[model samples]
Target: MADGETIARERIERLESLAREAVAADEEDRARSYVRRARRVAERHRLRLPRSFERSTCDACDTYLRYGYNARSRTQSGHVVVTCDCGAQSRYPYE
Candidate 1:
């Protein structure tokens, strides 16, 4: 079980890195696919994604958020608002 968890964690990290690279390369579709795969791995393994990967992904549509591209970000009322291309919104508070 520990070894399985380790493999799952490694796969999640690889997927997240690939997603980021795909987004940087302007491949939104590929990025989204990577995000979906990461999510599936997490769910299957009953593992939680790291905070950074969670922040970079959209919960509603399973889309990877590329700042200023598929997603727009703004600070409003002491929270950061991220709006995804699929019309889903996520908010995070800053200190």
Candidate 2:
């Protein structure tokens, strides 16, 4: 992975961790902010962050798309493409 991707992923992870903590503490407002930031990070990296309110399944693998490495769609050919920071893309919308 490229330096940018690595850094972005790490930052997203931190944000997620913090978000979880905020939720556990019942700090809904702060948790929402963290979630917004996390969503921004995911968008910046073109990871197609799942909707905050949508309970959608992966269109390909049928796995529950989690945040970070958990969100992605596979091609019809069955490739485990990590849409976040893999640096090599195959089944993206453009291709």
Note the Cα lDDT for every prediction shown. 0.92, 0.54
What TM-score does each of the candidates earn?
0.90, 0.50
Alpha carbon deviation, residue 80, candidate 1 (Å): 1.1
TM-score leader: 1
Q: Residues 38-60, candidate 1, lDDT per residue (tens digit)?
A: 99999999999999999999999
In the range 1-95, model 2's lDDT, one tens digit per residue, is 88888887778777766766775676656766776776678789976554432232233322323445444555554544544233333343333
Candidate 1 lDDT for residue 12: 98
What is candidate 2's local distance difference test score?
0.54
* TM-score between model 1 and native: 0.90
Candidate 1 lDDT (Cα, 0 to 1): 0.92
Residue ranges of candidate 1 with Cα displaced over 4 Å = none
